[model samples]
Target: MYRSRPGATIKAIATDLGVNPETLRNWIRAAGAGHGRGRTEGAPAVPGSSVEADLAAARKRIRDLEEERDILRKAARYFATETGW
Candidate 1:
């Protein structure tokens, strides 16, 4: 699930899955280590880590939020005008 959603933080995923954040982190670490892709504690991110993907996901999320905000603003304005307030 983590690899599938680049925008999701570990905390968010852990909360959704009803698991502790550290437990989730450890699970991820173990999974990576099993695949020979894990990094040592305090080591830099591995090459497989998708920082670009995460950034793009974040930008997409921002855009979606902005669009929703704009729609709500327009709706509010329409309602206010209708009410003459």
Candidate 2:
């Protein structure tokens, strides 16, 4: 589930799963190290591939959102000055 989300935090996930954040972090680390709960054949061998792609997409989306926010702020200032408010 955490791998599926772009900006999800460990604490948030732990809360959702009713587990401690550190516990979840440990699990993630262990999984990354190929420890605990043997991998299934269907699982992607290169986890970094999907994770990096997701990170890139999330970063791009963040940049786009920041740009939109800046534009909106500028427009608000323009309108405010135009109306002498």
Candidate 3:
């Protein structure tokens, strides 16, 4: 009901319900329906969506490096065997 009335403030709703504004704000925030409303004043910012992208890139790099290392090791072993070193 509160969500449908987009222009209604928490304070107004609280006053109408005879409840505290802060309490109503808490309810709205807990419901995740007050992201843009109420005192978002002190909430910490949500973290890196880019972190997943970075992690994926890092994983790909690691896999590539491991493959390169294995190839180099095999080459070194092959040359060692051929040269009797």
Every model's Cα RMSD, please? 12.5, 12.1, 9.4
List model 2 lDDT by residue over 20-60, tens digit each: 99998888776662354345666764678889999999999
Candidate lDDT values, in order: 0.79, 0.80, 0.78
Candidate 1: which stretches are off by over 4 Å? 1-45
- Which candidate tops lDDT? 2
Ten residues in sequence with the least summed lDDT for candidate 1:
31-40
TM-score list, all predictions: 0.45, 0.48, 0.47
Clashing pairs in 1: none
Candidate 3 minimal-lDDT segment of 10 residues: 38-47
Q: Report how far off residue 26 is in candidate 1 (Å).
A: 14
lDDT of 3 by residue, 1-85 (tens): 4665779888889999999999988777665667664334544333355677899999999999999999999999999999999
lDDT of 2 at 82: 100
TM-score of 2: 0.48
lDDT of 3 at 3: 69
Global local distance difference test of model 2: 0.80
